[model samples]
Target: MPPRPRRRPSDRTTRARLASVLALCLVAVGSTSTLPPASAHEGAADPAHAYYGILGANALDLTTLTGTGVTAVSLEVGWDRLEPQRGRVDPVYAAQVAGRAEQIRAAGLDVILDAGLQYPPSWVFDVGGDTRFVNQYGDVWQGQVGARVPDAVFNPRVRRAQNRYLHRLSAVLDDGPIAAIRVGGLWYNELHYPPATVGDHRNSLWAFSPTAQAQSPVPGYRPGQGTTEETAAFLTWYLEEINDYGMWQLRHYRRAFGWRPTLQLLLPGWGVRPGDVDKAVAGGLRGATRGELTGALNEGLDWAGLLPRAATVRGHNEAYTTWVDAADQGTDPVYESPVRHLVRLAEPLGLPVAGENTGTNSPEEMQRSVDRVHELGLTGLVWMNAAQLQDGRWATLDDYRRLLAP
Candidate 1:
């Protein structure tokens, strides 16, 4: 889970961490160069068969996993953590990834790469043309950890360098028994812009880059302060720009891994709005959309425009939605899961949508996630941090076993 920013006093109960995501099947599973040929035979297991996923594999003694039917493990490819320098991946991080991959494969589980570009190296900050993402407050988000979200949409060199990093990292993995790779930018391995509530700034919009400002539909337009028509126009561009970033990564992922593995596009907790639904209708996606689009314009998420492109990416793709918000936020009016709405959008296009819980710390929370997963008929539910299962206080191993049992 991405760290939550301090909230404004008036922003009580709002799902401020829009980057925490809703969930997704997160990259479909297909016959890849690394996998055994038997998994691909006709009438064998479906190519997209894995349901359960664990995000942090190294944190746990994965060899102990069994009987809970955990099918997939997420390989964290944090850019800074992987590539401390520019030319190649940090060998230590690559070795850790490889070791964890072997543990996951030994447990008869699949592997998925949750590629995160949040923590760019020092050189990435100087890649090209003011490459760091600037929020509405002129706060250029940068750090060695999860702080540096790049303006890749505006800087082509940043995209090239990032993809080159991905290609290099993939080579280090050396085509192991991997099922999928979840491609994302911004934060938390999910494709989203920076959150709105970064240290009590409620009016956070991430379109202040030099090129973003130059390409603005309504120059000098602040969100919600402009005319309704101007807001819509700016928002359309904002969301489409984010979608363009998503598409660019998808193209890179295809080129990086070729047609061997499937891909998943992650959408954060931007609840779908009636306007989005109206657009969905206009675009012939569905009769309606689901959930109100919370932090939609601020987060630069245009689900109506983004989902179709993701579902059609290179044939086999999954709509990865995050369901932790609805479970965590409970009845909070501001937070919602677009799972049902995503189902409306994804199913019509034959796309498989799945989810992941931000964290299932307690039995109650785990049960809530499980209940929603069953209710929505999601492809599967991924437990975000497997290490949490070892702690006996919140949720024990048995608790996760019970909560996640198929």
Candidate 2:
């Protein structure tokens, strides 16, 4: 009898082997690509010589802020106030915003225009209902920071409307005081969905709109179906959606302003408990993260994708770090510190990293925060609100001013 022919591998087995090899090759390529080049920007920024910036119009008080040596200010430009009606912006409100930007510039301070999409007009709910995101529990996520917002970033209709608003804002402001635009009104002026607090009835996971579902890679996915695998997939998708929205705003800014003004993505700059993220995954990813989670594909900001889209990435974490230290929370210093991770994320992208004081840091914590910024050579430092500059806190602002002064 003829020798039996050798058994052939099944098509499925052959395909699996090929796929594994292909994945390994891709991983190798990706790993090599992310390595820092000669002369990374992370250590290039000198916090000692960095610009001292402040958030809000409190810095607009030129006499007081200038006296403290502030060089920049961040202004919150409200979307609802600017365009309360669809296809039309209130002339008075628009003028007020434009005037504010101009005044900040005339005062010889760099201005960062914070246009938060979270401040959508009321009509948005009615007109763009299809784009609104329904959470796993079949409830729409709304009333974020007291404003009703949809998962509008990825929605085509919403993006178009927002693009129009940005254009109008640019036309009115005329590129005078605008040094940068920090986009995002998600929650607390940072990125990510609403809180996934335990026992809360509201759903924190979003972008479950028909549009989002249609674009979703996961087929037949439903909310509240808590499974680790499914939750992980959703988290990955949601991060991409965030990246898309960020890139969208950057593009719109360029179109309107005829120049790519520095685009900043304000991040919490704190770390979320992995256990909390795990719980959120079980709760349909209720947009949970303690700080800027950037390592693996979990429920955190996708800094790998976002840092490239932004010219500047600012984190609000130093005060939290101070609180944790003061309270003896025993948090990991490296994990809690946004400077190390931000420098790592932004260095390859050549983006400047900035930090904001939470207005709660003690004098000692303030010094540590400034020291970290200086060590990392961060681009700038901004005090969160007016409180840091008022009363006896004037010395606090003055300290940062002198430290950051070139």
Candidate 3:
């Protein structure tokens, strides 16, 4: 039989057909086999919450955050951008920051101003170039090999330069609406030296300069790559110097602000792996497991010494790497608490703790991370790089808003 010539469908009919296909696709995606059942207790919106905020880059839209129950905004002011010249603060950049802070304050939202010390003005490196950290290979640590921060934190000259910027910054942003200031300049945005290797790329050990060598607590300490003890001592010296630098920055901020606003120091949540340090050290790194190594290696944080100096301490954990969703980890807080160890240390000191999930985190992961903050009884949760949420992560955002609501 001859096939009947098919008639062209009308525009209305085509539109209806397309709609039907889309509806069916949505139904298929929503089928029980594809999605877990929504639980009543999972992520209900709460109306009362202490503080729900978002972290952003320059020029945040205050309206968007204010409407979403965000009580605070956290942003960074790069030293490299504001004070490229050694000991000279840029007035233009200062005004820009002050203006933005004023706008955020006018909107009735608290502000957290972070000034990075690790990534400092290039000229500072030039001024103290000889003091830049030296790696195991005697190679001067530069940004190229993960040795970014000039290893001059221990130098009095560098400290004076840092304080000068702080003094100038406080003067410019004077009387602006800043609720707190986070002082940190570690490589990954918290307090820590750059790792020995950033993925397959081996980096040199830092602070091997003659100045650092002379200041080392362990005499005859060589910075070159060697056995476990050398690495351990070098790591210890690095921690002590950085921790001291962190405290130094905190004290200067306190003096500049006159205790008008809270100051925060962020400590990385390296994890809670309690074990024997001597055993871990005696056993070479290859023999020492990750758990043993974490406990022994992380002693550098010395939160006991640093946390007391700040008004409040916030733990910043990279969720993409540190947190696993409850669904994936059987709803265990152990799997979810990125800063469990930090929380333990902060709680006893009567320090109110806040948390943040930085970098790229999936919407589902974001929900779990936010929930973990409250579950741990921390003060608040700030989601970093809020611009990344525009890609239909509102469902996740809404869940966070509800979870954070009182």
Candidate 4:
């Protein structure tokens, strides 16, 4: 996760060539070159889509991921991990990432990198003084407050720094070898919660900072105070900020390289209802729960709309079965409306839609989910938590490979 180490003079040129090739590939795919259309191949045919990769939780268990015949790996690389201190990167972590990337490539697998914002460096928090109730580590502190937490993605200063960080990170791997770049995550995590609970014990409120608050475009907004109308406006503005940040990154990759990498958005969980212990859940209509709403957000994105431009639009479908099966015990109509809407959404964009963080372990449930995916005409699927493979709960990597086999 650290910045790549200094290289020998000869290696520097080699790295540059590698970076150039990656940039060229992106450009060719995005530009009006006479190259074949991006979607000409199916997910099964694309080497990048062959094996469903796990997230950071599973990636930490390298032995399991590698042994399960996983053809690709995806993990959250925190900003702290890449640059632990102010402007200082650990060379060892960089080498490890590079080494692992090569290993995966050598084994004929793919690598999807996630540069995340959740775990930023400690210095970032001290800049405007931790005003949010929740700290960066997701903990709530009593009687400690300051200016509102800064929305790093929207703050010009923070945004510029983030862009630089990503550019450098990409430069390191662009030439070295990797499959795709995940430019976003569960971006809605911070925006949807009420401002009063911004740093509450349950919600991750402390994650916000004064810088984000001061730079907010919303008028007369304070760190922990806002009227209902102001709250709604702030939420809308924040969502736009997230969308803009993502689009900006996408555009940069397209303009600089000629092809935009894939974009992924994490769907919220089904833990929205009271008494739900899981953090993944969110509430929905008619007691439907968060899973349905999560799918709805994906539908709203019109994921298919990115086909002509983006290489892929992946949904981190975290709540697919968690809430569905939970509600199956009762006759809640088990509405398929969200899935139906998703199908309609994808039909026009002509881009491939995929589930990237499906955590279901039951074979029956997994198969049912797969059926839903097929019903909605999704192009690919990636199951999270590779350790589940050893437990014999979820389908093994071979199972997914077979599903995607030619």
lDDT of each: 0.62, 0.55, 0.53, 0.41
TM-score, model 3 to reference: 0.72
Candidate 2 weakest ten by summed lDDT = 1-10
User: What is the Å distance of residue 199 in model 3 from its true position?
Assistant: 7.3
Task: Mark the regions of model 3 whose C-alpha exceeds 4 Å error after superposition.
Answer: 1-49, 144-147, 198-204, 219-235, 269-272, 284-299, 302-336, 393-399
TM-score of each: 0.78, 0.72, 0.72, 0.58
Candidate 2 per-residue lDDT over residues 1-406, each given as its tens digit: 1111111111234334433433443343232223443235447565556666766553345667766667788666677777888878789877777777777788888887777566677776665537565655666655434335666555677777777888877887885746766655454445555443214643345556676777776755754555778866866677787767766655666677655455555665233322434545665644322221221222245565566655443322111111111111222332324455566656666666766654445666666666666666766666655554554743366666665555
- Please report, as a residue range, the 10-residue window in candidate 1 with the lowest summed lDDT: 22-31
lDDT by residue for model 3 (81-197), tens: 678887677777777778787877888888877765655777776555364666444666555311266654556666777778777777878866467776555554455554443
| Best-performing candidate as measured by TM-score | 1
Find the candidate with the highest lDDT and give its number.
Answer: 1
Better of 3 and 4 by TM-score: 3
Runs with alpha carbons beyond 4 Å of true place in candidate 4:
1-51, 56-70, 127-150, 185-218, 221-235, 252-260, 267-340, 358-360, 393-406
TM-score-best of 1 and 3? 1
RMSD of 1: 9.7
> RMSD for each model, in Å, please?
9.7, 15.5, 14.6, 14.6
Mark the regions of model 1 whose C-alpha exceeds 4 Å error after superposition.
1-50, 224-228, 276-293, 324-336, 403-406
lDDT of 4 by residue, 1-406 (tens): 4222111211224334433433443343332224232233223223333335554432444554445545566644556677777667667766666666666566566676666554455566554533233332344333211122234453455555566666656655655544555544223111122222233322232223454555556544532355545544553454455455545656654443334344443332221221211111222112122322222221123222222334342322111111111111111112222233333334445544555433445665455544544444454455654555445756665665454444
Order the candidates by TM-score, highest first — what do you get?
1, 3, 2, 4
Q: Indicate whether candidate 2 or candidate 4 has the larger lDDT.
A: 2
How displaced is residue 185 in candidate 2, in Å? 4.2
